[model samples]
Each structure stands twice: as C-alpha cells, then as structure tokens.
Target: MPTSENTFHLGLTMAGAVSAGCYTSGVIDYLFEVLDLWEKAKRGNVQGIDQNLVPKHNVIIDAMGGTSAGGMTTIISTLYALKGKLKPVKKIPENPMENQNVLYDSWVHLDDNEEKTFKKIWDVDDLDGELTSLFNSKVIDAIATKALDMGGDVNDFESYVSENLPRFISKDLEILLSHTLLRGIPLSVDFKTEIARRLKNSPMHNTFEHYLVSHFKLNSGNPVNENSYLWFNPFKEKYSDKIKLSTISTGAFPIGLAYRKFDNTQFSDEYIKSVTRRVIFGDFGSENPDVNHDIELNNYPENYSSISVDGGAINNEPYREVGSILRSKFHKDENEYQNYGLIMIDPFPDNDDIERKYKEPKNLLKVVPAIIQTLWNQAKVKRKEMLEQYNHDFFKGVIYPIKHRIINGEYKGRDKNPIISASFNAFGGFLDVNFRVHDFFLGRNNARNFVQYFGCIPYDPDNGNVHPIHREWTNEMVEKFKVSRRGDERIFLPIIPDLNLLLEGKEPGDDKYNYTYKGKPKYNPSELFKLKDNIYNRFKKVLDKGFDSFGEKTEEESETPISDALIRREYRRNWFQRMGDNVKSWVVGKFKNPVKKAIASMLSKFVIKSILEDLEQMEVLDDKAN
Candidate 1:
C-alpha cells in the first residue's frame, strides 16, 4: 500500500471530432459539471464518493493531451483550472461559445461597463454595410499596406489576402480577439509575439510549463511515424519563439481552410532547402492514426522544420501520450502506478446506425459521419488494447471503462442507436439537452458503474458472492450531497440549478437554487480591475485611430429622394382608398360574423379589382415615360 506522502497522477485526454460541433459543446458542458462536482467533493459537499474512492486531497491533473478541436478545449480548460477560475456555476447554456460569461468567464470576464463597451464594438444594426466597412478599413487596408511595402499590386494582394484569410475569420476573429483582450493581451502587428509574451508573463505559466502541442510534417510521404511527429513545448526557452505560432499552425485544418506558413525569414536557408522551401502547415489530425500504440517505442525527431499537420490523423485520443509519459516517469514500482488516475473526455461522434440512415456517401454531409466512424473505430481498438494491457499487468487495474449512452430525445421515428441518437441529439438541440443528458447519465449511471467496477472490496471465491460498491443514490441524496455547510448558514446553491430543480424538491424555474459567489473573492482586485481598464483603454485607442490609417471613411450627408407630383398624387389616392376599404371590410366582418364571407367576397371583387386596375394604369404610364 502506498503511503500518504505518495500522490496519484491524473491524466486527462480530450478527443477530436471536428464535425460534431454540438457533441463538442456537450463535452465542454460535461467538463464544467465535473469540475463543479470535484470542487464540491473536495469541500465535502458531495456524498457519492466512498472512503476508497475519495482522494486524500483534490486530485491534481498530472498530464493532459488532446487533438484538433479537443486540443483547443483542453488548452482552454487547463488554463481555466490553472488560473483557479473553474468555479461552480449554473448549467451550461445552449451555445456555450455564445455564453462566454458563463463558460469562459475567466477568459472573458466583464464588469457592467465593459459589457457595454463590447456590445458597442460587436452590435451592428446594419450588419452588411458595417461589416463591409470594417473589412475594407481593417483587413483590406492592412493587406494593401503590406502589399505596397512589398511592391505587390493591390489587386493581386487583395486576392491573396482573401485566399489566405477567408470568411471564417469574420466569424471567429471577434471572439478570439475578445478572449485575448480579456486576458490583458493587446493586439499588435505580430500576434504570435504578443501571445508568447503573455504566456511567459502569465501567473499560471508554471502550471502549463510542461504542456505539449503535437504536430506532423505535412509534406511527409509516409503516414505519421515517430520521425513525422513534432512536439511543441511552449514554455521551453528554445522553442518559445515558434511555440504560439506552431500551436495555431497545428490546429489549422486542411479542408476548406488555408494552410499556414511561417513568414520566410523565420526559417534558416539550410532548413528551407531540406524541405524544398514548401512551407505549409495543416491540422495535426491529418497524421493521427487513431489507434492504441506503444508510446515508449516512439521517438521525437531532432529537427524543427516548417511543415506540420493535425494530430487526429494518427491519434484522435492522445491517452497513449499521457500514459507513456507516466510510465517513463514511474515504471519501476507498481504501487506508484496505482496512485495515479486517468480521465479521458472523448466527444467524438461514434454511431454507425444513425450514419447508415444517410445513404449517399459522396455527399458533403457524409464526410462528418465518415470521420466519426473512423474515430469511433479507432477508440474501440484503443479500448480493447487498454483492457488487454490491464489483464497483462501493464495498467495494474487503473483503467475504468464507462459505456457510452446515447441521449436522443424520446421522439417518434428517432434513430435507436446510441451513437446516432447522441449525434442527432447534440445537433438538434444545439447541445442544450445533450449537456443535460450527459450530466444526468454521469450522476445516475456512470458514477455508480465506476464505483462498482473499481470498488476496493475483494471478491469471495467461496460462494461467488462479491460485495457490491454502495454507490447508489436517489435525487434527494444527490441534492443533499450538493448542499455545503461552511458557516452558520448552509449554502444550498447547486452547481447546476436545472438539475436541482428537476431532481430535488426545488420548484421548476426557481432561480434561488443557482450557484452564487459568497465566499472570499476568487479574483484579485488589482488584477481584475486593472486588466479591464487596460483592455478598454487599448480598445478605445484602436477605435479612435482606426484599425488602419488607410481606407478610413468620412460620414456622408443624407440626400432627399426626388418625388414626382403625378406619382405621389396617384400613390396617395391608391393608399387612402385601400386603407378605407380594408377598414370598412374589417368593421363589417366584425359586426356580422355570419355574413363575413359575403362581405369579403364583395370587397375582393369591388375594392381589390379597382386597386389592381389603377396600379396597372400607373405602371403603363411609368413605363411609357421611362
């Protein structure tokens, strides 16, 4: 048995499912709930955990890995956790991204006034003209300025810029900028530099110093191998220059998106020559094989070149990476291994039955299903390998398998398959119900199953009667567990209000059950207040000076429309007559319900016919004059 001094490691793995947008949202919501639950458990607010299951302390994540969108989520979650911003909150909103205040309050925290400032920047009543003006003033002007400096034609540069920076930026840039700004990082000429600087200066930098973002060689002919892999450690002084740039480069998907390239100066002549100067970067998933493989045998290539791709092509789930790192560090002792726990959050769509409903394989919509199936198959293979490894004493009984539950709503003609049902559920509800289902499943089923599966009770061979892990709980039990008594007054606020309302005695739509901040303030006063002021001041400066100096528009004076006397006279007569007839018909219809049909008929013929005749005569006159 391990002593109290020995601490167990917890590895977190996030899975890639690029097309499963809603599924990803559900996964995020699930993560938020888990964090909240963990916080409660640490404070002794929750009761599901038995003595054997309870950690001596709050379990710290030893390692974290992810691929593609999963990678992005992992980074965001890790940052939040490290910053101590993973607070207990309300249930996740329908679109987690849109509800930044709740899902990512740490990243985009706003005061009452800051909210108004952001609204001013983003709230465009005339979307088209404002958007067009914004593009011309910002994107077009920047490209044009850079092009002129490089002695390139404006037309050619515009085309190139459009190709490199497509419409996706229009959707994503604002949100990204908003996040960066909230983090107190200013937008500069070189964004990568600013990001690197911010990372280095961040108080939580030590927490993520060992973080790795895996990339692959895009131009490599062979499938992803050890040589093809390029692991980026952003905190390392040597790779610091390219770390932030490489992270984004690795995430840039190849399909329907431009592959990123290092500005020519970043590469050495020899390095450039070796790769034939074809510098292109794509998603790490392009090289992810998505199978269970021994990471011990793999090698990291010595050279750092320009070409890179997604990790999903080789491994959508990077648990192998986390496992390998742990094994390397503590392979000598079996007891050491038992101390660590691994939690993988896989949101990839993995249903075949629902996919089969769509017969056309070549259609654009089929691509998502195909990717889901491929990733699902990979996960299955990896799960099988994990079970085999456990039997062989490789994992040493550390692995816990949870069955995937499909959460499709109870609707007629719904696909019965769990995978398909989950996908449809995620897609149709935009992750609102999907998140609820995910939380419910974990509380009601997965938690109990996990406890039973990994219970410490020894099996009796005499009568073949094994003592079951007593993890069963009712709605009331869960509610009781969520309530915390730290002071004179018990804090009955639940992390997820909807869950409490639905499961507990709380009334439906009761806001009182919602979580609220009442203890010591989580944020530092100086940092929080200063960061907000800094961001707002910087934003105001940018707006005043314009995004770029060139292509600035001056307000134009309004002009009055030229009206014709004959047309106005004819139009007024038609309008008044039409209004009068409508009013008369309405009054007649109201007074005589039985005779309404007769009145409508008379109006349609006598009133509508005259209007149509007059409109035809006006059209003839207008056309002849033209």
Candidate 2:
C-alpha cells in the first residue's frame, strides 16, 4: 500500500490525463448537437447562409438581406476592435488591422440594392469603390448574414484583413464593442487552391503541419491511430498561439473552419432562393465529416417536390405548399435531445444586380449545438439555482431592512451601511459554470466530440473559496477539493505511475515511472478514472432507458440514481449539520405576505430605477483609445 502523502499526490497527477476524457464527453455532446442541426439544415437545403443552429435571446431579424436570429455574437466579437471593445487580460492578441471606433446596427443593413448601397473606399490597396463595394457586399456579412467563405483565396482574406480591412469598416461600427451574445466563434482558415498548393508541398515544416491533420465528425464514432481529440480548447498552452481567443467568433459552430465549395456559378444567392422557394425535399450535407457536396435540402413538413436533375427552374404550378418551414435540420439521433434549434432563414429576392451564382457555394453555416444546450441549459439551471439559493435564506438578519432604509435616504452611516451596496445588485457577477462547449475539438478526439470539465468546486461558507461565474477554473482546483474531501473520484483512482507513458510501449519505473507513490509502484492511475466514467455513463444510459426490467418500472420507481447534489449536500450536512449548524438561517417575526403586491411594487421600482441609470450613463462603457 502507498503512504497517504504519495497516494494523494499520485491520484492528482494521474487524474489529469483522463480528466480530459470526461470533459470531452460533455463538449462532444454539444458538438454533435450542433453538427446534427447544421447537417439537417444543409440537407434540408436551407436558404439563407446566416441560419443559426444555436440558442439565443435575440429576435430573429431580416439582416444581411435575409432572416437570422443568431450570428451577431460572432460578428460582434470579430468586429469588436471595429467597435473598440477592450480585450480581457491574458487573452489572445488583438487584431489591430481595423479601427475600433465605429459601430453598426446589427439588425439592419445600408440597403438591399448594391448600387443604392454604394459604399466608399479606404484601403491601402487600390481595391476601391466598386471593388471595395463588391468585397463588403460580397465578402463581409456586416449586418445580414455572418458566415464567411474563405474558399477562393486565402491570400484575399489575408490581404483584406491585413491591409484593406479599413475599407469595409462602416460608419456605425460599434455594435460589437460590448460583450457579444453568441456563444462559441469558429474562425475559418481556408486551405484550398493556391493556399493548399503552397502548404502541401512545403518542405521545412510540412511534416509537422501534416501531423496536425483536421478532425471531422458525422461518423457514428471515432477511430484510433488518428489524431483523435475532438473537444479542443483554443486556450490550451500547446495550441494557444494558433487559437486566437479574440478572433474566435461566437458565430462559428465547429471550433475549426469547415471546407465547402459552390459547384455551379448559376447557383447565385437570389437564384437558389427563387429556384427552390417551393421545392419539397433536398439533400444538403451528410453525417460523414469528410463528405460534402452530396446532401441536398428542400422545405420540410411540406410535400417533397420532384426536383429535375437537369435542374433550371421549378415548373410545378408554383402552387405546391410546404406545410410548415419546419426546423428540418435537427438530424438528432434518438439519444440526442432537441436541446435547441437551427432557425430556418429567408433568402434575398433578385431586386439587386449582384452576380447570382446558383451553382457555386457562397457561404457555409456552422453549428455549435452543445454550446447552445450549454447556454440554454445554464440559463435554466442557473436561473433555478439563483432563485433557490436566494429564496432559501432571503430577507434574513435585517439586511433587507438596513438596505431599504439606505435606499430611501433614511439611513446615514459610513462603515455599517455603505451608500451603494453591490450585494443586492447582480450587474457584475461571475457567470454560472455550466461549461457548455468549451472546446469543439479536445485532445486526440477527432474534433467531433464536445468536451468540458464541469461540476462545481467544493465551496465552504466558512472559507470564502468559491468558483467565479462564467469562467473555466483550473483542473488543479478540482483535484485539491477532491483529494481534500476524499471524494468518490479521489478515493477510486487506481495506482498507475506511467499510465500515459505506458501507452507509448514504455514500462513503468523505467524513466520517471520508477517513482514511488508512498511506497507502491504507482499502479495504472488512469484505469480508475476510465472505470469511473464508464460506470457513470453506463448508469446514465440505464436511467435514460427508463426501467431496469423493461416496462416493469412504475412511476414511483423503487430506487433512483443518486444525484451529484444529493451526495455533496448530504456529505456537507452529515459532516456538520443541515438547517441548524452548517448553514445559518433565521425567520423574521413580522414578515408580511402581501407577497404579490410587494413583489409587483419592487419590480416596478427596479425597472424604473434601472432605466433612469441607463439613460444617465449612455457612454459609461465607451472604449478609450490605445
């Protein structure tokens, strides 16, 4: 047996390697959810390029000359510097190519017609006037859609972003100067044509770059012998430089840029919409990550129109009604729940003289489903916790009375009663931890599976140690808490000295493997974690399947699987005491219950007061120049 000191330290080091797997599972769930929605949308042959498959709170609008409720998040972040938003500390380097003083109305564009929307030019390169207009109108989504097709020329993107970007910066460019609404942003770095040719044949770093192969999903699962990590953190030390935190748009779905091409020149934006406006069934993309240009799509919940393979225009009476513009893109397997949706977008009509290409694929819509679920579910779960956590001990210890007196200007004290108390206000609080989709492609997982390490760190009211809102804490915190408390995880980790190295055909105790854990040959530590995850997942599947004995299970099932909360709460209470010792709670003697009237009155006060504050400080958050 290993000594206590060695045993605990050994556990921590070992768990780190396998910790990613658990996080990966969570992230993969989101990835699949996103891919499923996008694939379905693409297969359904959805119209607009801005269709979002994620969950958001914004109203769906007709922007970018079409309809979409999402993508603003990505556009906002990418255009952040365009709006002068300050970057967070220790974040990726900011792109200094464009000005940060402008802001755009995200919901509306300049005009539908290209000529009427004639924009000016301001680029170092001579790509001006009509050419600049073409790029902004053609390349930048600006207001309407948010997907970028970096297909034809990586050089064009490199130059546009590097040199001529100022040309497209509109008058109102500050729309994204604040925290954006979209969740995860996928940055596209296209490798095609000249770009592909140069890199594929390069000799010096070609071998290393080749090793950094692209990972794809859509296959039921992943295969070994490939670079297979899917749940990726752009913030990871190894790939931090390659992953630009500032540039990662919340608009992107998959963490990495997907590759696609428009095969026909006639398949212009207006033509495709007008052409398939009434089509029934269409194929778009498939479940295979490597497969594209194979799927087609048409309106769903409507009759599948007979699409002529020769394909020019629809001749079928122009009266076939597709029932509902159903969210046909959510190609979820039975196991995956409909956590969120991909909005069906509208297409632009041919009132504009823009060259229409029905054959060539102009833009691609990406999906980050697990992130959608993460944000959506967090909103729900965190909202519940916020309500529950407060309600349980709310209006206690006369804090409310003291605060009320101060708000009404009745109380005046420096130390005892601060004039402005942030305790009651939630303006600046740590975001809830529900690591939705931290990374689309995690380590060696083929970028298909979503992954994130979640589950709240142990908090002690006596000790002010707590988790910050909306941030990913270090794995070290979890390990410390787990081992300190002898958690099921810490207790269960097996003894494995060189578990990771063992995979490389090296024997334990040969190099750094010979190290002792208290006294024992550090047993394969990773096996414990693998076992734990396997056991947990198996149990989850069992519960999801409903009953142990098929239909024999009743509504009041004899037994229920233990919840994380239950275990932690019980432990806390047993170790100290619930309702009496560990937690402090007090009941007010003169508590009034005109609860309805007071609640309504309070809400009215909050709204009016908040509006006044907003009006007074419109530029409180304005960005200062560098």
Candidate 3:
C-alpha cells in the first residue's frame, strides 16, 4: 500500500509482477529475469552494473518494468526517473493497459490480434464473472429479452447497460500474441456460459430442499461464539473423489483461484481431514514434501478430469512416431496423460518418476514454508516496481485521492474505472491484500487460513456436514501441530492460530481446552469479532441441501441445517459493526490525506485520463462560447 515516489525508487516494479494479468512464457520469463535483477538490484547491480535502484541508464528496463507508456508525457514523467538528460525511449505504444477506457474495452472484445496488448490480453473469463452480479437483477433479463426481440432502438437500449457491465466484459488481461482468442463478441461461447452461471444461483437449483426443511437433521446455528465470516466451508464430494465444478460457487468480488462450492455440507471428519491434506500437500504435490521442484510432479499424475477416456488409464506407450514426424522425438521417460475414474473427466498429462537428483522430498512442514518462500520470491521479483512505487516518496501524491475516494465511497458506482472493474471481473479480481501479505511478506503460517478460507467449497457430498476451514484429516503432521510439538520444521504449535482463533484470539480456557478461563486472565473477542457473522454458514446450508445434495448423498449422513434466523442475526450484528469500523477508518484516513496530495498521487492516472477529456471539454466550452 505504500505510495510511489520519484526521488528514491524503493520498489514499484513489484506491482507489475503481482497482477500483470496475463500468463505467458514471455511475461513469465520477464518476471523471472526481473527477479534475477531484483536479487542484483538489492545490491544495485544489473550485469555487474551497480547504481542507485533507479539509475538514468536503467530507464528502458525500469520503464518496461511497469505497465506505463513512455511517450513525451510519461517521458516527461520519467524526467523523475532521469537525473536530467538521456535521450529517453521517446516513442512508446500510446495504448497502455492501465490507461484509456476504450482501449481497455477493446481488449475485452476478444479475438483481437497482438494478444499482449492490454486490450488484447484482457481475460474474458473475468468479465463473465462481472455479469454474474446481475443474476439477481431483473433489468439484465429485460435487456436480454429485448435484445432477443431485435425490434427496438438498440442504441437507446444499450444506454440501459450498466457501466460496470461493460467494464467487466472488456477487461483485457494484456497478453501478447497467441491463438487464444482476443477481444471480440464471444456470443457463441458466452451465450451458454452466462446462462449456466445464472442457473447456478437459483434457489430451486437443488433437488433436496424439501428434505432439508422437513428432516432438519443437519441443522446448525451460526457458530457465532466463534468470530468468522462464513459459518462453514462446504465441499462437493468426498476427498479423493470427483471434483464437481458445477456445484462450485464464487466468493467475494474480484477473486483469484478457480470457482469454489462454498456450501459447507461436507463437515464429516473424513472431509475435514482430506481438505487439510490437500491444502498442505496437494498444492505442492503430495510427494514426501521434501524434494522441492517441478519434479515433485513426476509421481503426480497429470490431471485426469476423466477416466475411460484414454483406455481407462495412462498409456505409457511413447509417441515417438508423432514426435519424430514433428521433428521432436519423445524420450523414453517423457510425460504422458492419465485418466482417473468419473471423479475426473479430462485426460491429464502423465508424469511418473524417472528419478532425478532433486526430484524428491525429505520433509513435510517444509512444504508450506517452501511454497511460501517461493511465491514470496516470485512476487517480489516480478512486481517490485508496483509494490515499491513510492520508495522515492512519489506516492504521497498518487495514493491520496484513491484514499479519499475510498473514504468517500465515490467508487461504489462501477463506471468510475471501467478498466479496473472489467479486469477484476475477468481475472477474478485481485488477490486479497491479506493474501498478498501471505505471498510475499516474511511469515510462517503462510496465509494458511486465508488459503483455506478461499479454497474450501461448502456443499461437498462425501461428508454431509459443512466444515469451513474444516480440519478433515489428522495426520502425523497435523498431530504434530496439535501437540505443539517440534515438527519437522524445527518447531510445532508455532503459535499458528486457525481462522477461528485469529478471529477470536485464544482465551485462557480455550487454549487449554478448559472452555472457561481457570485462574488465568480471560481473553474476549475483540471489536473485529463483533463484526463477524455466520452468514456464510446459513447460505452454505441452503446450498448443500440443494446444489450438491451433499448432506443426503450418503446413507450414513442426514441433511440438517443450522437455524437461519439465528445465523442471520449474528452476521447482521457483525457486518454492522464492521461497517462502523470501516467508516471510522475512512473518516480518519480521508481528512488526513490532503486533496493536493491525493491529486498529486493519483495525478498519473487522473492526468493521463483527464488530458484528452480536458481537451474535449475545452472544445465543447469554446463551441458554447461561440
């Protein structure tokens, strides 16, 4: 959140890396090279050239480092980057992704050429997400209905389209060149996709609502005594079972990761244990958690979204004929694709072990920390410029206005920044700042709770209970955590609190399992907890009974939902309190930020946008004057 500064550029490049949007070899390589440079930059060296972090000679590298244009305007802007004079790379592509509204829209169009251009690279999937907000809106349907009619004034009707909608649709993720379609009407693809999302949101989307209401077996009240946003995180099926994409639900706006089924029907111990295992090892590949590398994927079979597709299992037969025909012969130990059962539906690339040196593991807890460190390195290396933009103290002016507007809530309306909105809708938006901290900031728990919170799906059919951040399985590793024993990572019970504990810090008894504080001091839930609610639990319960029939899918399980009213009350109280806290923060942060400072800070974006807008307005004024 630090603002960018010109005089002393600390780390602005990080931003570019953090959310560059597109994923390509070029961007990836650039990011990696930048990280290499960053490692050197920490010592102010680029190819043995050590200077100030922002040296006049490093202009091109620094300029290209972020998503900015380098024309006279930004060239003038780069005057800050220069000590005084070095012929700047005066000509820059005028269409920078971060600037320009129409350009952003162009990217969202899909099927444009030059996939890397911000507009071309804009990811359409995110835009599809934005349309989801309108699921409850009757207006979109009316518009769609009218559009289908093909009779009325399309232009006037077009005006009915919310600014947020277009922005969401046209978010160009800034890819370079690829067969991947760029900005164009995806009606052929989109028509059905849009319909599917809406269908998912329907209350009647489930088959067992009657059972849930009638039986009331899995009934749960909001776990309110515990501070949390969602009462339970649901799942779609049992662990090691088929992952049902249909039941998955999107949580929060501008999300990351894929869709999740936030229903929480799967609360059985089995479910919880599986989730824990996956969260820890599954992500890094469940090898010994010792050998750290892509090689860990060696034993890991390629994703088999289906079975029976590829002869019911992996075919080890090499494709030397095809490879030879294509002038690339296959290695005896080359990767292949595997097909798992109905639990998976797609043929996954196959990878078994041929046993390379570092292609193995030696420990377990090292897995979490290893992943954390790796992401941290990558994030810092890639997005240093964006992250440390204010290192030179140039950010005071840039961020003030954003701070003010956020305080003022001016951006509650979507059109304020169409590009940002669309971009978020497509890429599932930015990762939560807390997650960013987890990714980069030196920490141990490694944003574990945040990941659990985000990755967990609610209405899992395997276990008929909703377990948000559920501890599904207790392995030796987990038990090590429980006893606070020294696990492989040189320690256990490393004071890593679960989401519930983080939300409600340990009380005297809770820590000791005594339930009530004995002779020790009592710790209570704080103001933040007051704003916590179990609305997630309520919503998940309804979804579990319906979306996946998770609760009743098994003969051993009974679908019971917790009290809706009770849960709603807890959340309402929590949310209301949170609203108050936010208001307070806004009031304090806004006034403290001066308008000039805000303008100065946001001036890059504001001025960039307003320059042409100002000219247009001036002409209109002149016409009126005439």
How big is the positional error of residue 83 in model 2, measured in Å on the Cα after superposition?
Answer: 25
| Tens digit of per-residue lDDT, candidate 2, span 83-165 | 22222211111321122111112211212223212121111122222111111223122322321211233222223333422
For model 3, the local distance difference test gives 0.21
lDDT of 2 at 178: 10
Identify the leading candidate in terms of TM-score: 1
Alpha-carbon lDDT, every model: 0.34, 0.22, 0.21
Q: Per-residue lDDT for 305 in model 2?
A: 16
Q: Candidate 2: misplaced stretches above 4 Å?
A: 1-140, 143-146, 150-615, 618-626
Clash count in backbone of candidate 2: 76
lDDT of 3 by residue, 466-485 (tens): 22222232343233223212
Quick one: best lDDT, which candidate? 1
* Residue range 1-626, candidate 1, lDDT tens digits: 22323333345566654323223333444444554554455456666453333333322344555665455545444333322234433443344234342323311121112232222322233233322221112211221122112222233323333343211111111000000000111111223455675674433221101112333221111222333343222223333244344434334333211233453344333332222211111112223333353112112223323333344544566665555444443344543324344455554434457655655578769888898877646533555446645632332222111333223432233222222112221221111222223332222232222222231222232444221111222344334333433462322322122223222434422322122211111112232232343333333333433433434676775353355555676677667888999999789657654454344345334432443243233221122321
